[model samples]
Target: MSSVLLFFQGLEHSPLSVGLRASEWMYPLVNTLHILGIALLVGPILILDWRVLHRRATPPVAALATVLLPVARGGFGLAVVAGSLLFITRPLDYAFNTLFQIKLVCIGLALLNIALLHWSKAWGLAIKDNQFSQSVRLACGLSLVFWLLVLALGRLVGYR
Candidate 1:
């Protein structure tokens, strides 16, 4: 009866949701794309984070970022679009799912970590001088943790 519930109910009954729910192939196709998108997003992130953490073992941070950021951004975009479509199919269910809630939180934190890192002077230090300060290293470590949590929680959201 509340506005939020009403909004979700409306989403659940939308033409797009109804069509996706009734379709035999569309849901599966979107699900596949969501998985692929996560793969693309997480894979680059893992490599980049690891490289940042282990500064001596990889190429320059800027070089790797230049190559990886676009792929990660594309993946994130795809995932969000596909995920939104999937969510609309059962808006209330996802809106209430605790696992889904946690997944969203983890994703937010991961994105925030990225924003903070890029905005801070640590980023330039890491990129130009190959120097990662404690905060930068901690951010990279947290990025890894947050993303992994998001991945696991996403799977659990579907499992439950």
Candidate 2:
């Protein structure tokens, strides 16, 4: 246990980690950016998901994705960067937190789902005809579920 603790002690005591811990203002600022990233990433995603689920009737999926995926990617950039900074402040907490682990797994599942969707024929159908197969609908449903779980687990990390 001491050896495991020692491993994180090195990370927690890093210069940047120490600085982040010491800065009263920066921590909250970075957290705010993380939330902003989540918003940017999830907002468009929800909109797209709504369309997939027949909850909306506006832009086609491919057109909407063309506009939104890049935005989500940009938000993902902000999230990973700020999240890394925040995680560095207390690596042990994140490393051990069950919810934190769950959140990471959910994020990975969501990414994998999207990758699989892109590789399927539904992607071409969506781009060409704005319609997709049942598999894509299932993927979209899973995407929504996984992302929502990630959000919940992310918030839960703070409780522990």
Instruction: Compare the candidates by lDDT and give the number of the best one.
Output: 1
Candidate 1 stretches with Cα past 4 Å from truth are: none
RMSD of each: 0.9, 1.7
Cα lDDT tens digits for candidate 2, 113-154: 989988987877876777766787898899999999989888
Overall local distance difference test of candidate 2? 0.87
Residue 77's lDDT within candidate 1 is 96
lDDT against the true structure, per candidate, is 0.93, 0.87
Model 1 per-residue lDDT tens digits across residues 82-134: 99999999999999999999899999999999999999987987788878988
In candidate 1, position 20 carries an lDDT of: 99
Worst lDDT 10-window in candidate 2: 53-62
